[model samples]
Target: MKATTMKTLTVSLTPHQAAMMQGAVESGGYASNSEIVRDALRLWEQREEIRQMELARLKRAYDEGMASGEGREVSADTLLKELKAEARSSG
Candidate 1:
């Protein structure tokens, strides 16, 4: 595997946060503070990507519903019954 290019960053940590990083290094859990920061950023990036995908899905659903034209009001119980009937038939 090829290594990605790295850039240096200056970060400020609270006393507790600084201690946590130092403890991890002392315990051999991480090679350095940079590794821990990189891991955190990777996780944050993944979460942001998932959030964006979900937002897109919600937007599509909203657009589809709006384009579907005027809607009729149905009772909650009636809707539930219809949904259950559909599920049973499909299964």
Candidate 2:
């Protein structure tokens, strides 16, 4: 196993945030404040990765939609009327 070098960082937090971390340690769920901060960072990193992936997926979908056909402008009323007509005819 490879040894990883750890760096110490100083972070300033609000009283509420500080209390929350202290509570977690007191609850025995976490060994120390560092563990809580590391866990929170891991969750934050995961959420950021997911957000980037979703944005990329949306971009691809948008590109595909734009490439599918020519765009047309239609009012809500016109669209509703057209849809109703089509439904009536199909029925």
Candidate 3:
């Protein structure tokens, strides 16, 4: 990839996380602390995108369920029944 424009950032980290990033750079897996930070930011951004998509899907499902006029009431028995069904399917 071509080197892109730069952004300056400064932040503090826990000792353990700082050590881990330093070790990763020293281990030749990353060229510099900036590289490590950029990679981490990219991964976090991807995760945020995934979470947003999941939330949108959930909202759509909730809206559709409401439109279907299914009972919105929940009781202990209903919760237990769903849990039991999940356990049975997994086991």
lDDT of 3 by residue, 1-91 (tens): 8997887878899999899999999999999988899899999999999999999999999999889985867899999999999999999
Q: What's the TM for model 3?
A: 0.72
Off-target runs (Cα >4 Å) in candidate 3 are: 1-3, 70-91
lDDT per model vs. reference: 0.98, 0.97, 0.93
> What is the lDDT, from 0 to 100, of the residue 38 in candidate 1?
91
Model 1, runs deviating above 4 Å: 1-7
Poorly placed runs, candidate 2 (over 4 Å):
78-91
Each candidate's TM vs. the true structure?
0.79, 0.81, 0.72
Task: Please give the lDDT score for candidate 3.
Answer: 0.93
Q: Please report how far candidate 2 places residue 7 from its true position, in Å.
A: 0.6
Kindly list the per-residue Cα lDDT of model 1 for residues 1-91, writing each as its tens digit. 9999999979999999999999999999999999999999999999999999999999999999999999999999999999999999999
1 versus 2: better TM-score goes to: 2
Distance (Å) between predicted and true CA of 33, model 2? 0.4
